[model samples]
Target chain A: DVKVTQSSRYLVKRTGEKVFLECVQDMDHENMFWYRQDPGLGLRLIYFSYDVKMKEKGDIPEGYSVSREKKERFSLILESASTNQTSMYLCASRSGQVRGNYGYTFGSGTRLTVV
Target chain B: AQTVTQSQPEMSVQEAETVTLSCTYDTSENNYYLFWYKQPPSRQMILVIRQEAYKQQNATENRFSVNFQKAAKSFSLKISDSQLGDTAMYFCAFMKHEGKGTYKYIFGTGTRLKVLA
Candidate 1:
């Protein structure tokens, strides 16, 4: 089975602290994404990487950054964690090699609480 | 920009009954994909069903099926023989085919479904 593994299931961070959420996929998928899920906003994309060392800002990328050093790993970074940033973060991956439409495999998600 | 809407925030259905979750989307692209994703209490999102815009026939998977209306841009998911395991948050997503395997998904706010015994 294809798996998207998120490093943390739950996290608590102090305001102004830098935070890192890691995601790794074993399927060799070339596309990785980071999204933050909030109550009314649903899942808003923050960043995505289509290839190693290449990243693009999604709809909501104000306080977030991403790094894809290798094809298998993608990391979402919170430069300065704020209380407003508290939400459930999800990591997803899809096969770039696949033609046409394909569904994404998402990780279990990381619920972050900022104080 | 593409946007997905799931107006029903919560829904309840009895076992063996059927429930349909509504989803509507707005996009200019002619070719795209629609999907229903289930996020269980464990917080893992899984694909339940998918529909391609070019296909006129509704897609079905076992008891799960979709009612895709291309003209109205509506893609609803119907779950038959509801089970306790079916209780979860369902999200409607839209992905515009960018060609060469490049696309991004826009998801709805989600509908929470609870199956009663």
Candidate 2:
């Protein structure tokens, strides 16, 4: 089975600290995305990478940055963690080919709490 | 810009009963894809069903099916024989075929479904 693995399931970080959330996919999918899921607000996109070293900002990219050093791994970085930054983070990947698959396979998600 | 709306924030169904979750989208693009994704408690999100706007026929998988109304831009998911495992948050997503391989998806707020015994 194809899997998108997140490095951490739960994390607690202090304010002003830099936090990193890692996601790796074995599927070799060309597209990877980072989204923060909040209650009532649903999931908001943070960043997406289509290829190695290629990244695009999404709807809510503020206070967040992403790195895609390799095709299989995408990293989300919180430059300065704030209390409001605490939320459930999800990583997803999909085949870039528009023809075959349109669905995204998501990781179990990382729940980060900032204090 | 495209947007998806799931007006029903919460729903409940008895086991073995059927429940329908409503989803509506706003978009000018005629060619697009609609999807329903389910996220169980503490589990990864998974795709439940997908519908291509160009197709007139609704898509189905086992006890799960979709009611697609292209003219109204409404796509709803129906779950039959609901089980306890079916309790989860269901999201409606819309993706416009960019003609190229790269595109973004817009998701609804999501509907939480609880299965009652």
Candidate 3:
């Protein structure tokens, strides 16, 4: 089965701290995405990478940055963690229409808390 | 920009019954894709069903099916014989077809569904 693995399931960070959320996919999918899920706000895209070393900003990209050093890994960085930035972070990966279906395979998600 | 809307914030249905979740989207593009995703308490979002804009027939998967009205830009999901396991948050997503390339999905706020025994 294809799998998307998040490095941490839960994390607590202090204000002004730099937090990193790591995600790795074994499917070798070319497209990887980062989204923050909040109650009543659903999921908002933060950043996505379609190829190695290439990234694009999504709907909500403020206070966030991404790295795609390899095809299998995508990293989301919080430059300065704030209390309001705390939320559930999800990582997803998809292949480029190998079978005409572009469904996303998502990780279990990382719940981060900023204090 | 494409936007998805799920007006029903919370819904409840008895087991063995059917429940429908409403989703509407706004897009001027002639070709696009709509999807329904289920996220249980575990928070693992999974694709339940997908509908292509060009297909006139609605997509179905087992007891899960979609009502795709391209003219109205509405895609609703219907769960037949609702089970306790069906309780979860459902999100409606929209993605425009861009050649063979993949586009980002715009998701709605989601609706919480509860199945009662």
Winning model by lDDT: 2
lDDT of 2: 0.94
Tens digit of per-residue lDDT, candidate 3, span A1-115: 8899999999999999999999999998989999999999999999999889999999899999999999999999999999999999999999974765878899999999999
- The 10-residue segment with the lowest total lDDT in model 2 chain B: B95-104
CAPRI quality band, candidate 3: high
**Which of candidates 1 and 3 reaches a greater DockQ?**
1
Q: Which ranking of candidates, highest DockQ first?
A: 1, 3, 2
Instruction: Identify the runs in model 3 with alpha carbons over 4 angstroms from their true place.
Output: B98-102
Candidate 3's displacement at residue B31, Å, is 0.4
Error of 3 at B78 (Å): 0.3
Model 1 agreement with the true structure over B12-84: per-residue lDDT tens digits: 9999999999999999889888999999999999999998899999999999999999989999999999999
Assess each prediction's global lDDT (C-alpha) against the native: 0.93, 0.94, 0.93
Candidate 3, DockQ score (0 to 1): 0.89
RMSD of each: 1.1, 1.0, 1.2
Candidate 3 lDDT by residue in tens digits, B1-117: 788999999999999999999999999999788899999999899999999899999999999999999989899999999999999999999987655464658999999999999
Task: Give fnat of each prediction, in order.
Answer: 0.85, 0.82, 0.82
Fnat for candidate 2 (0 to 1): 0.82
Predicted candidate 2 versus true structure: per-residue lDDT over A1-115, tens digit per residue: 9999999999999999999999999998999999999998888999999899999999999999999999999999999999999999999999886674689999999999999
Model 3 fnat value: 0.82
